[model samples]
Target chain A: MSANPVSRARLFGSAAIVITTLAALIAAVLSIGPSGLVWAGIIGAVALGYAALSFVLHLSYPDAAEAAWDEQNTVAHRDSLIFGFWAVLWVFLVFLALSLTGRMDPAMAFYWLGPVLGAVPPAHYVVSVLRGRAE
Target chain B: MTTKLIVHLRVYRAQAKLTQAELANLIGVSRKTINTIENGVFTPSTTLALTLAKALNCSVHDLFALPE
Candidate 1:
């Protein structure tokens, strides 16, 4: 939200990390090679580090971070859930049609469902921000 | 048939010389929350509305009003 250079730099850095990590994850899953474990380990380590940092921040800066978290949980999360509703519906409908037409397996639809639904929030956020309509 | 909620938060925020992020920090909300509330894309809860009103040095009714 802060368009200051420092804040923008930090946001871009964080986004870069997320993008790279996700790309690695997808490649790992697709290839199922030895690097898969490496990628999984990296992701696990990042998750653990993030959790630890968040715990520390919550403890140290209880008011600021917790308030933000509360707002996110109550407000942003509610919006995300609404978006997820339509996202899941449309995704399933499309996938169902694809499966019925013998293009994709029905089981794959169920398999991809959670990830696709999960992506809706970040996707919406990114698109909204890019379009300057996030507010 | 029902009228949509209209928020005059941006005017108050401008008068207070506060950016959305600054006001959000003051009221302990995410900037996105403040931005959305100002743009009328989202409405604040009662507590948040009161908090915003207090921070902006205005009454709740002064901060948010019907279009009459």
Candidate 2:
């Protein structure tokens, strides 16, 4: 049988998380200063903590780990995408409004866009879990 | 009138003496998926409905129905 769509989405989400974290880490490292060091440390700790948690969960609950990307998860992912689209659009609109009023720099608005867009999936997943809608 | 899909999955699963996790394993899904379907909180796809019916040794109609 073909792989579940939820499973595929989870794989891509995990990849996105890793890539963004790596990019942030690289950017932090390239700029050397106390602030840069602090950002790098914070990012490193978060990445390591996530990896450790996933490893432990996989080892401790093999069945749950295997089932993590099931149909329920797919439904949650789909809902999250809908939520994310609206959220991103709202953020863009707000930024556009501010830029037009000369209250915010367009470049600054664009800089914040990437992180906000990247945050949607994980934020939605957390909300779903809290609502007991997704595993 | 809005029609809701009424799922009889729990009754059949109970008759088969299978736990949610067991049925999930049989159908290659998660226990959460089985639980949600049983509670009528989530509707399974056609493919999943067929797989669940096959796993439970029943027809899709037997496992699910709409109120008349």
lDDT for each candidate structure: 0.64, 0.72
Model 2, A1-135: lDDT tens per residue?
Answer: 113334334444445464655566466458543553454465456555666666665676665566776777877978887877888899999999999999998986886565557666666766676566776
Output candidate 1 Cα RMSD.
Answer: 5.1
Measured with DockQ on alpha carbons, how good is candidate 1?
0.36
Which candidate wins on TM-score?
2
Candidate 2 has what TM-score? 0.70
lDDT of 1 by residue, A14-112 (tens): 344456466765774597545744655664565455556656655666655644454433555466568878988998999999999999988767756
Query: Which numbered prediction scores highest in lDDT against the true structure?
Result: 2
Screening candidate 1 with a backbone cut-off below 3 angstroms (N, C-alpha, C), the clashing residue pairs are: none
Residue A81's lDDT within candidate 2 is: 79
Q: For every model in order, what is the iRMS? A: 4.0, 1.9
DockQ of 2: 0.51
Residue B26 of candidate 2: its Cα lDDT?
Answer: 81
